[model samples]
Target: MKIGILTSGGDCPGLNAIIRGVCKPAIQHYGMEVWGIQSGFRGLVDDNVVPLEEKVLSGLLNSAGTVLGTSRDMPFKRRFSASSEDKPSMMMKTIKKHGFDCIVCIGGNGTQDTAYQLSKLGVNVVTIPKTIDNDVEGTDVCYGFDSAVSIATDAIDRLHSTASAHQRVMVIEVMGHNAGWIALYSGMAGGGDIILIPELGYNIHNVGSKIIERLKQGKPYSIVVVAEGIKTMENKKAAQFIAEEIEYETGFETRETVLGYIQRGGIPTAYDRNLATRMGGFAAQLIEGKQYGQMVSLNGSTIMPVPLEKIAGKARLVNEDNDLIIQGKRMGICFG
Candidate 1:
């Protein structure tokens, strides 16, 4: 069987590992030819492909980005270029001409939705969930979550020393889109004074009070962590607003650090590499089993396939009532 794999959506840390994982098993054990689709579906539309021999897959286990490259371009959204085609008919024609027995999609929620739409057009597709957000539904965890959380947590840890020495309020912004996993985990792990996630909208006055209370307790420094997607009444960014509010409320020097793309880059953590490896191999296994229109997912300790319909148009947001939040509350961590 000739299998095609593509990485879509925002770039993540474990993409190359997934490519290596799939190519290794599919080529050696299953005797399947692997073809890489470049730049997600846009590449597919343009017939851009590269053969994935075993040699190309080597030394990529520890790599961070996708060798096949990636883009956020979608078939339904003509956002990439003026010449972009939004129709799947062209995609179907390209798939038929290439004779891809099966195709694997490595991406997050939007990518999965596109995969489902392609499957409906009679394309044989399997998906692997990958995002730093860890918000894809029907999976316990995604591959890139560990690596991103580690980076964000490390940033927070380093910020603590500087904030202490300078006696300032440091507002660190981490990426989460709409979920609070990154903010919550990094905050808990790095001992943040306050955390703000999109799941729970925060009151500026309450946050100011907390900073003032910390100051009253003789704590000169404070560390506040927030998700990039967190919003205020006018959908403004939280970092600058929080910093200004805390400074006015406590009369302390406030600084904002946005860990933008740095969290998305760098080497994949061991956990992400292992997870991507398992997911990729499992995707190959599914293709070998003739399982189409499914997504390879992790349920507890087992790797398995889930129906595409279940994952499309759905996201797994952090549960406000989960144990993590409860523990954070118990530990006196502010989740504003």
Candidate 2:
């Protein structure tokens, strides 16, 4: 059997591990020919591919990023003329020419949507969930979340000493576009006094009063962690708004730090590598069973396949009554 593989959307730390996991077993056990598609759907539409040899798969388990490259390009764009075929048709033409029995996509929500579209177009496709935000619906935890949470937690940990010495309110911004998993987990682990997420918008008065209460309790400094996707009424950045409001309300010096691309880079954590490996192997198993139009996900300790339609275009958000939020409240961590 012939199979094609691609990684799409934002790059993650465990992509290489997933590729290695998929390539080795598929080649050795299934005797399948794996083709690496470059630059996501754009490469498929353009017919840019190379064979994924076993030698190329060696020593990639610890490496970060993807070897086949990635992009956010969608295949359904109407790039051609009215009389000509659409981009998805062109991609299908390429698939037919190469005779790929199945295509494997390793990416986040958007990538899953693309795979579902392709499946609807009569292409056999499989997906593996991968996002640092941990917002994919079918999986309990995505591969890159642990690595990103570790990075964010370490950054918050390092900021504590400086914040204490200067007696300042430090506003640390983390990346979580729609979900609060990253901010919630990291804040809880890093001892953030105030945590704000997109799911539960924050109140400026409450945030300021919390800081003031901390000051009254003889705490020299406080840390506020905010998700980047959080919005203010006036469309201001959440971290900047928090800092400005607290400084004005409590007369405390405040500073904001945005951990932009730092969370997206770096080596994979051990958990991420293992998760990626398991998901990748499971994807191969789905292909072996001829289970198309499905996505491989981690459901607790078990790896399983879920329908692409069930997970595509849907985000798993943190509930207000989530155990983490409840524990945070119990531990005296305010979610403002």
Candidate 3:
């Protein structure tokens, strides 16, 4: 059988490793041909593809990003929902015309949703979940989460020394378009004095009081971890909230550092390397077993192939009652 693969959404670590996993099993075991589409769906739309072989998949098990390259140029573009029904049909036609017997897509929610639609159009598809945000549905852990949280945590850890020397309020901002997993986990791991997430909106009184208490406790320096998407009690964006909070509250010099795209690049963590490899090989196994339209997801410690529908329109947000949030609050970490 012939197979095709593509990566979509924002660039992430471990994407190339997943491709290696898929092509490894397909070629070594099933004698299948795999081709990679360049620049995501647009690659197919524009008929740009490169043949993938065992040799081509070599030495990328721990590499980051997609060798096939990627882009956000979806058939639906930013509409997300409006382009699904019709654009997916066109995508399937493009796949079939390219002579692919099956397709494996490795990406986050948007990519999986498109994979499901294309499968319904009679294209056999397998998906591997990959998101640094860890917000995709049905997966306890996604491939890039480990590396992202590691980078974020380490960034905060490094900031501690500088904050101490400068004796300033260092507000380190990490990526999280809507969720706070990165910020929360990094906060705990990096010994943040304040942890702010989108999940918990706090009043100025709450944030200011915590900073005041920390100052009273004689800690000259404070490390505050903030998710980029966090919101205020009044429901404004966290970046905006930070600006307002900085203007309204006073005591120490405030500085904000956005980790930005640095968190998405770099070598994959050992955990992500292994997870992507397992998920990739397992994805090829599923395709051979005739499991179409499924996404390989890690359920705690086990990898389970879930029907794409199970993840369609599904979002796994950080638990509102998670111990991290509750414990952070109790320990006097401000979430504003």
Candidate 4:
């Protein structure tokens, strides 16, 4: 079998590890030919590809970012073009020209939706979810989540010393547009005084009260961890808005730190590398079994295939009643 693989959407730490995981087994064990598609679906539309030899997959397990490259390009999405060009049709042509039996798409939510569309067009498709947000549906956890949470947690831990020395309220923001897994996990792990997630709405007054309460309890410093997508003023960023509001309400010095793309960079954590390897190997196994139109998903300790239709266009979001939240609240950690 000839399989074509591509990475899509935002780049993260575990991408190269998963690519290596897929290519190594498919080449050495299954005796299948593997091809690397460059720059996500754009590569398919543009017919940009290269043969993946065993040597090409070496030393990638600890690498950050993808060697195959990636993009936010969605061929299935409608584009207002002057020329009469159909991207999806062009992609199908490339698939047929290459004689690919199955295309293994490694990406997050948008990539899953596109893979499903390709399957509808009769192209064999299998996917592995890769996102630091941990929002891709039909999977208990995605590969890059562990790496990102580790980075964010480290950042929060470093801020603790400075916050204490200056006796200031430090507001740190982590990535999570539609979900709050990063902020919630890192905040609790890093011992944040207040945690704010997009899943639960927070009041400025409540945030202020939490800071004031911490001060009254002989805690001169406070750490506020917030998700980037948390509700704020129309044109302001979450951390900046919250920091300004906290300073205004309590008359305390407050500062903001946005841990933007830093959370998505660097070598993947050991947990993430293992998860990516498991997911990638499982995806190849599914292809070997001719289980097309499925995505490799992590369900507890097991890696299994989930139908593409079940997860396309869906996202796994943090809930208000998450166990960590309940435990944090019980421990008198404010959630605002």
Best by lDDT: 4
Better candidate number, 1 or 4, judged by TM-score? 4
Whole-model lDDT per candidate: 0.89, 0.90, 0.82, 0.93
Ranking by TM-score: 4, 2, 1, 3
Worst 10 residues of 3 by lDDT: 76-85
For model 3, residues 123-227, the per-residue Cα lDDT tens digits are 888988888998889888988988999999998989888988987778888899788888888898899987777777656667667777777899877788888
Q: Comparing candidate 2 with candidate 3, which one achieves the higher TM-score? A: 2
The estimated TM-scores of all candidates read 0.96, 0.97, 0.92, 0.99
Residue 227 displacement in candidate 2 (angstroms): 0.4
**What TM-score, to 2 decimals, does candidate 1 have?**
0.96
Report the poorest 10 consecutive residues by lDDT, candidate 1.
Answer: 78-87
lDDT of 1 by residue, 1-336 (tens): 998999999987868998998889999999999999999988888888888899999899997788999998788655435544445766777788889999899999999999998998889999999999999998999889999999999999999999999999999999987998989888888999899999888887788888888888999888999998888546667687778778887788999999988988988999898898899889999999999999998999999899999889999998789787898889777887
Clashes of each: 0, 1, 0, 0
lDDT tens digits, residues 190-278, model 4? Answer: 99989999989798899899889889999999999999999988679999999999999999999999999999899999998888778
Q: Who is ahead in lDDT, 1 or 3? A: 1
Give the worst 10-residue stretch by lDDT in candidate 2: 74-83
Q: lDDT of model 3 at residue 334? A: 72
Model 1 residue 239 distance off true place after TM-score fit, in angstroms: 1.1
Pairs that clash in candidate 3: none
Q: Write candidate 2's Cα lDDT for 52-118 as tens digits.
A: 9889999999988899999999776447666477788888988999999999998888899999999
Quality of model 4 by C-alpha lDDT: 0.93
